[model samples]
Target: MSAPTGKALEEVRAKAQADVRALRKRVDHLDNDAIDLILRQARSHYAWTDKPVTDEIIHELYEITAGGPTSMNTCPARFVFVRSQEGKERLAKSLKPANVPKVMGAPVSVIIAHDLNFWTELPFLFPHEDRRPHFEGKAEHAEVTAFRNGTLQGGYFMIAARALGLDVGPISGFSNEIADAEFFAGTSLKSNFLCNIGYADETALFQKLPRFAFDQVCSFA
Candidate 1:
């Protein structure tokens, strides 16, 4: 694809600028239904319908999630989508009893992981400068950054799925060691968490739980 130029570039920039202005106004915001679909009405779905989540949808989900920002664009998040029966069985071995059925029943279980040596790609991802050397000997700092950003990316994945009309049940009830051995063996990647993705069974949800109010959770410097 040729790079957009002239009128196309101007149109793109103009649309982006208009979007920013609209966001600043906060008046032409997402409709209530859209907000609900992405956040409010969304739930951590444990039970799923029989509808299969296709590869195309998974690809689209990754495309959307990949757009989320990361520090120095490290983007260490790695996903292993377990959709086959054998994959589910392997994942089940790592899950707690209560979470096994959830994983097995969902259309797909995503193993969200991060590469411990993510900084090795800093030269490519953040190529404007030589940044890879900074993390070469800093194992502790690199691991921390990878895990933190990987977890954040997983959150973005869940939101992206929700935005695409899919339900997600993210859980930490699985054995990371087992997951790593089964799915990421001989690799630098380490499992962060598991997320079941599919259409939800509304009847399977429990009453919504309460959340801390904004006033109770925020403070000014």
Candidate 2:
């Protein structure tokens, strides 16, 4: 779509600012159904229907995910949407036997990865200070930061996909080495996880699993 300009851009920004102000005044939480759509009711779908996810939806998903916060705004996450049959085949050798079918059947499998040298872009993303020097020779620190923030972005990606009415199945049962060779070769990027996105086949869904109570998982300091 064409970029919104002049009065249109101003109106869009105004509406967004108004929404933020309105939310700050709200005390009530989201309704149960709305909550379920993004969290409680969303399932890790293993089976997919014949429906195809369009490129437009994928772009919209990124648009939403890109808004999520990252450490020092270092946004290290890089995505490879493996949609073609050839791409799936290339990925198959890296996946565990069990995850192979789920990935192959899905319309799209996303390779969620991080750039090892994400700090190099800090000048553009976090220009207030010279942050690149902090991580220039700190290889260990850079790797940890990249993995932590990139993994967080992956979570954002799933939430964004669900909000867009798509199901998500994130799996880590794969060889990182092989995946790096197949997808990130000749690059500083490294694989973190894989997520399959598509419409879920309800008939194949398992019963919702239970979760720990709030008290069981949290305590005041």
Candidate 3:
């Protein structure tokens, strides 16, 4: 495949710009209830109920999450859903002892990883320009871009899961080396984080923790 020419790119951009207006006309913004459902009232679950996260739901969540923007649309995230007992057993070996039980109880645990060869897809994803040169064969550069954008996609994945009515528990309490060896052997992928997904057991929740106020963490530009 080839990159779009200047005129072709302009036309595509114009159509997308027009689409923004059309989309806003249908739903200008999400309401407070929607916001609360997706973010504010959402909790990171520690215990999960028996309800399973189905394949259809996983696909549905991905369809929405993949729409999230990444740097030059590199979209490097690679997800592995561990639902079987055998898969869970392998995954648990890499998780910290403290996180193992909760993760094991989850109906599904996803390994979010990034591909070092992500830029190879730039010709297809970011066809307006040949962006591959920025990362191709540049190991250090590719790794940074992959991890950064892949992590952004990970956040989108959690938000999408919440929006789809599944509770999420994201954790970095695991050994990356072990996880990579177990799941990504002989591959360019590197594990970023793990997220447990299922119907949460609300009773297991801890007291809400305080977050930094705007003034405490923000500053004027």
Q: What is the C-alpha RMSD of each candidate to the true structure, in Å?
A: 4.0, 4.9, 1.5
lDDT by residue for model 1 (34-131), tens: 89998988889899999989999999999999999999999999999999999999999899999998998899999999999999988778765778
Looking at model 3, the pairs that clash are: none
**TM-score per model over all chains:** 0.88, 0.89, 0.95
Residue 201 CA error for candidate 1 (Å)? 1.3
**How good is model 2 by TM-score?**
0.89
- Candidate 2 per-residue C-alpha lDDT over 148-177 given as tens digits, one digit per residue, 9 for 90 to 100: 999999999999999999999999999999
CA shift at 66, candidate 2, in angstroms?
A: 0.6
lDDT of 3 by residue, 131-210 (tens): 88887678999999999999999999999999999999998999999999999999999999999999999999988789
Q: Which stretches of candidate 3 lie over 4 Å from their true place?
A: 3-11
TM-score top scorer: 3
Task: Mark the 10 consecutive residues where model 3 has the least summed lDDT.
Answer: 1-10
**Stronger candidate by TM-score (1 vs 2):** 2
TM-score: which is higher, 1 or 3? Answer: 3
